[model samples]
Target: MSDADYFKNMPHDKNDPNPFLAIYMDQSIPFNEEAKAAYLKDCSSRSRQFLLPVLRPFARLMIIVLQLYKIIVPKALTSSRLLHRVLHFGMKTFVSPSANFMILRHFYLGSEVLGFIRDNVPGVHIEMNPLKPTKLEPVKDDLFLIHDLNLYNFVINLNRELREKGTEVTAQKQLNFSSITSSRIPIEQMPRRWTNFMDLTTAIECFTPVYQLFLTDNDFWRATNSLQLDETIGILASKIIGSNDRLALINNKHPMVPLTTLKAGFRLVLHGLATEQLHALLVELKLKQQKEAAISS
Candidate 1:
């Protein structure tokens, strides 16, 4: 019987039931899930599933809303300072640090995933060169990155190319994020603001049992890493960064399906200015490195 005809899943190879142990055995995973949820063992509630025909008007209204709003939404990043700061508080409080970190990590992970496809596939596969990883040097107040992690990552990518050729920079650098964003949103307000930034850990430990009543870490990770996910966000980064640096291997893919909503467009804008400022910082570093080399020689 075809898999399409019924719910079907393959049997796990008992001899190698846990294959991830082999795949990542030598490498340190950049993110770790610390929570042990008994909920994952519980069977899903198979409640009656039926789409209500009564909600047709509500669905139609949403379509109309999308049609009206999509026309005015900006397709790329914005330069407005006020808008960045205004959205700062809400995004900081409601969004998990782990979500922000993984999304930031997506900039690299997506590129790597696509690259593996290109090298492995023989027929008309496109090249996907991984972006150079920017190793942040130890600095005071580094935790401020949790304030606007997307912008922080955007800047890192913006400077990566220039840093690659200009000088033999030590694989360490301090980011003065204030130079990029002067927002007075105190870093203290961000959860776990004092935690070590360099550690390869996740904020999954922070979710409380009360919060997990509806959706546990298992649901969150599965959703966050896949659909309802950043594959779309990856699409945005690919477009902004360069034509060659795109993440989606699937043709005709967009960050938003059917429509790009106003809120989604605003995210692109948030990454704009700080990305610009971070570029300037790297440019200055290149010049400084050259000047020091000249003086010593």
Candidate 2:
């Protein structure tokens, strides 16, 4: 079934044998005994077939690398004000706008979910804090678990409404050279100021979680590195440093690049911990099924 159809047909009843409900839904109400038993059995089979073997070694390697980095890097340098400033500036100047835009989209979707829950769900208090450019925190409460699921539902419903009114979004036109030149003129004319520095720091702070999430996804990592990630890094460095000669001097030798790469790797390790947690829950469910099956047989 298509993804939209799958989500649309998701069973609301607790007794329904949908595995996604177990993982994605709030489980305040217990499922019927028979349905729970069947779900447990399904979890066991799926875990053994699809989850454990692939994830176990990946998790182990991730932990080892993170531990080693902690041992090798001094806390003082890691926390240096100048170093952080440089890193922030480098990231802002070098990272593609596409990445920044995608992260912003996630924040937007999250805000929409918060609003929906607040207006619709009775007795569930939702926090309405503004999205900080720095420091993206989790929702204050469990009122919006399964953010992606909720965002998908929100978008689908919105599109349906728009379609019923015979309205469709138009495609964006390509930007011309004149438009691009005009956009850069303002920044070129402006003098470097403290607020610019503050904005850079704030952007870094807000982007940390988005970067972590992006790095943790194995597919994204693979796709990013497929064309030699260092090559693009080199180009960005050349532009910032104003010479290919300086680029060669630093090149792949810069500590910032390695440090950022390591940070991303470490974040992936943390992601592995989350995966392990889910795997453990599935294993427990599987064992429960086995015990019940033995009792029945």
Candidate 3:
């Protein structure tokens, strides 16, 4: 999106001194008190004036409620420490607050699986093909939802682990891929639902943060890092996704490619670069979070 569009759509106060608004209104009307009064009187004379005036005020109230909810709610509500405002938008539509905690726990399992994928999976990159972007449109929504939850779980787990280990006091404020990735354990072998659909690592990457959240100590992490990929996938399948009755039905009825295979396919098709890209993505994510934090503070 263009910067102009982004700022224009952004929520702002009636009294906001935003430069974007200044530019938008420049030469059209003066923004002083007298101009505002005349503008209101003119608007009052227009048809649908009452309805139109109410719309902007109502929109502002909604924005306030949303921001307030973001500040009041816990991060686990949507499996994210960042983007709670946006994520909560989804919940307001699709999810019930009563079930938020259960969903959050499921997300944690997914995060741990993602952790394994980062360290061990063969190099496969996500090349955003402009021409072919629409080809895989069907599964993209589900995949994105899965990734969003995983990232949330990862932040929560990482923050907790860093706090417990006394590794660094500012760990919550920074990203540490090495520390997190190095702690991954191999998947435990068991009845697995994901074997047919995803590469073990790729599937795990989809949801490892959720799994990592419940971990006890360094010993558990050490043990997990050693498990075979298949075994770990199976463990996750049975304990997390497979256990959910609604999701289990979807898995059993319509098994797509295995998560392991999907990873390889994504890498081959997309042809991604190294972890350096991750650095950029992480920086953007953090900056957005910091901005939100500042707004809330």
Candidate number with greatest lDDT = 2
Winner on TM-score between 1 and 2 is 1
Which regions of candidate 1 are displaced past 4 Å?
1-94, 122-297
lDDT of 2 by residue, 5-101 (tens): 4434576776666655454343432222222332333333443345445644554455445445445542313322333344345334542232222
Question: Each prediction's TM-score against the native?
Answer: 0.25, 0.24, 0.19
Candidate 2 clashing pairs, residues 3+ apart or interchain: 134-206, 135-205
Please provide, for model 1 over 1-297, each residue's C-alpha lDDT reduced to its tens digit, 9 standing for 90 to 100.
321111123345678653332322322221111100101111111110112223333444443453444335522222223232423332344333333333233333333333322232223223233432222111112222222343334334434543654532122233222112122112222233433221111112121111122222342222222322234334333333333221332222332453322122123222221232223333344456567779999
In Å, residue 288's CA in model 2 sits off its true spot by 43
- Give the total clashing residue pairs for model 2: 2
The digit string of per-residue lDDT tens for model 3 on 1-297 reads 432354446676778765545544453321222222222222233222343344444433443443344455523234323333333433333332212222332233234334532332223221211111111222223433444334434434544554666642211232323312222122222222322222212222322333223222232232232222223333222332223222111111111222322122123112111121222233334456567779999
Q: What is the lDDT of residue 118 in candidate 1?
A: 29
Better of 1 and 3 by TM-score: 1
Clashes of 1: 2
Candidate 2 matches the true fold with a TM-score of 0.24
Best by TM-score: 1
Output the lDDT of residue 78, model 2: 33
